[model samples]
Target: MIENNNLVERQYEAKNNDLAEEQHEIKKNNFVVDTEERENAIEPILGSELEGLDPSNYPLITPSIELTIKNRFSSWKIAKYYLKEYGRQKGFATKRYRVEFHRNRTVKKRTLTCEKAGKYKPNKTKPIGQQRNKGSKRTDCKCHVNLSSSEHTHYVHITFIYPEHNHTINADNKRFTTAFKHFDKSIMAEIEHAVVYGYCDIHMIRNLLQLKFSDQLFLMQDLSNAIQKIKCDKKVNRSDASHLLKFLLNQQKKEPTIFVQPLINVDSNRLCSIFWMTANQILLWSHYFDVVLHDNISRTNKYNFPLSLFILVDSEGKSRLGAQAFLNNETQESYKWVLQQTLDATSSEPNVFITDMDPAMNAACKNIYENTYYLYCIWHLLQNLPKRLKSKLALIEKYPNTYEYLHNTLYPTQQSWACVFVNRIFTVGMQSTQCIESINALIYKEVSSSLSMINVVEAIDSRMQKEALKCKFYNMEI
Candidate 1:
């Protein structure tokens, strides 16, 4: 019985020895794999250092790389090329590491680092009832290539590098794995130029980019972000009232004759600015056309402010823009303020002032320019005639002259619209407020209600300049 027990113990000891040998072999294999990985990491850095050097002069250990031909302008480009070539050879994904931006948003410094992939187990234990944290497992691969500008040298330096990747390199798709890729400077410049010239539509800009850089690949979102960044850098905001006012003030300062009057609200101190060319325009109006056409366009701007345009005829018989005013409301107070500003700017009351039959506008014109004849716009009166006569249509069956009765009741006299009753000398062959209406149509073509007040003003100015050029061309042809 003792011998049987000893035999069993001996057998168990032999099995334990066999298991120990297997474990030793497994650990030996693991050590080989780790050593190989470390060697792979260090090889690329050595290769980069010895790239352009004589093979005989290649040292046992290369601490840093030295560029034989120093380039100040293309330093970043050279660094990126080296990083890209290393990524291709090493077979790992790379990304931007640390980036520094200049005040004007140019890249002052940039670093490319390996994207370490795989799950990492933390050393700390989890508390009871707490879930395990699924934190990003990016390994400390210590792989990086840094490019920095040196002001003293006036050159970009490839300051540091660890050209080693812990993760498996994607050699098959090296282009897709490159880090810190961006549009070329030339492409970015073209995009900025397009935006400044009002070709700001994203889709159109995308098409332009594709056309210009056919070989290069770019994502739509990247292009969009670039555009937004450019606009933000330019400080272009349609909603900024203060900036708009400042822009107008600058214009006024540059041109002494450009009259700009800001009406301040007593309570809020909010402003409504009226603009006009006072110096030459007033003299032109006094000498040539004594007629003034006023029209109010509502809900045509982002602010919902009623834009009032004062127009006059030039010597060439073209409809000329005389003045522009913005109002928060179509009240008598607003109209009075606008009219009073006009009177102050021009210093001459118009002989004939034409407007739509708004009671506030009519009263303001009457009170401000007592000697001026206020003629109602026939087109506007006729537009309302249909709505007013809808109920009176039933009364037309009872009375044969019902239409004439309503017309006379609404119009009161013929001098308002009828050319026969108007003074021929003052009419200048103009019977209606068509000139002002045309100006409103021209403005609406260039601007929308969604546009900021500043953009609207810019569009108006652009349209005026275009029209003036057209007029000049026509006169030259004649």
Candidate 2:
């Protein structure tokens, strides 16, 4: 199949090459006819016919230089611009045919051809031998200008020009050509601002543009392309981890009350972890700093860095974000660094802490809050119990004290897992990480692995603002 496809492509290219050669022949003939007409028009007037006529009564016949050797420009760019304007005035269109660049990427030569300088080849998607319903604009016209420059010279010179065309030129028809259509930068800026701020109605924008540029041409595709370019330009070019740090820094600038700290690896100089808390988040922590529940969510961004969220329960029994962090790895040291940040932010350790079964996080919690109560999430413990006991049934039967051994193994941490022991603490009826897990679900809806780090930050901020508004509307006690 590949070989057959290659053969078909080669055949198509060969046919196009043949058509180009035939068009060149036609252009050569037209040039010859044009030259002869100019020669005949400028034929020397007979000396006898001019003998009796008064020279003042006849108009002076100077040479025509509009599209000839007399038309010279200071640079190739100026020459191209002149040709474009000339075409617009004469009701025609021009396009770039080819260009050559110097070793340093400077323009060495350029050619501008008529827009209809190529023959149309039917697309292969149509069935073979199908008749066309309409005609194509391509007429193989060979009108063009050649521009070249040399290293020794600073000016661009016109090397050749063929100003004759086989088709008629109409200035009114210029508006219909793609080459003459363009959107103003101011108009595009307005469209981008509107779309970015959530006013994205393409049809309405098109109508406005048409009304504004009544004398010029406007196409729907051009407007669409402009909007798409605006979107593409907003995408971050740096690594997500790097951009994440920059975004936090900027946010700190905008809101001086916000706190942002990043840990960098000394060897690789890459971001190891970052912790940030907004002004509102800090206020929330100040009000409800008694119980802290933190857990890591993975795959929330393209880099797969775990998003660590510290959640606090309000008086209304609602989960609120105290702060957030992104970690490079799940290590004891990383967790300790984050916990220390949270400690500094709140100015004191929580009376009660709850987390999942991760040993690193558990160890970090115990070391940081040595005097505070540290409890394991009951939901996580229940989910892992069946897996741990499914294979231990035979051992329990073989040795009756196998159950006693398991009990002894788990006895030391009974306070962390047993509900009866945890009921003594003032937890607002909360004993698990279910609240944080539910908050994770809401985060997933606002952010995803495909989003850029900057966009991810913006989405998270927007979600928080909405939640805050909802709380205010219902008069929920914070």
Question: Which one wins on TM-score?
Answer: 2
Off by over 4 Å in 2: 1-236, 391-409, 476-478
Best by lDDT: 2
How high is the lDDT of residue 173 in model 2? 57
- Tell me which residue pairs clash in candidate 2: 91-171
Off by over 4 Å in 1: 1-235, 278-284, 287-289, 391-393, 397-413, 423-425
Candidate 1, pairs of clashing residues: 91-169, 91-170, 92-169
Write the residue-wise lDDT of candidate 2 on 1-478 in tens digits: 9999999999999999999999999998788777646644654222222244333322212222256543445455456656776677776878998999888777888888888898987666766567554878888998988887655444565678888898877655554566566555666777777556644344456667668656545555456557556756764144657656766776677688888988898999987788889999999888887888989998787777888989999888889988998888899988999999987776777888888878898888878877778888888887766655655656666455556645764577798888789988888787788999788888787677875555456566756765775665465323
Backbone clashes for every candidate come to 3, 1
Q: For candidate 1, lDDT tens digit of each residue in 183-259?
A: 65677787787666754444457678788777555554456556656765776564346745665676677667767
TM-score of each: 0.49, 0.51
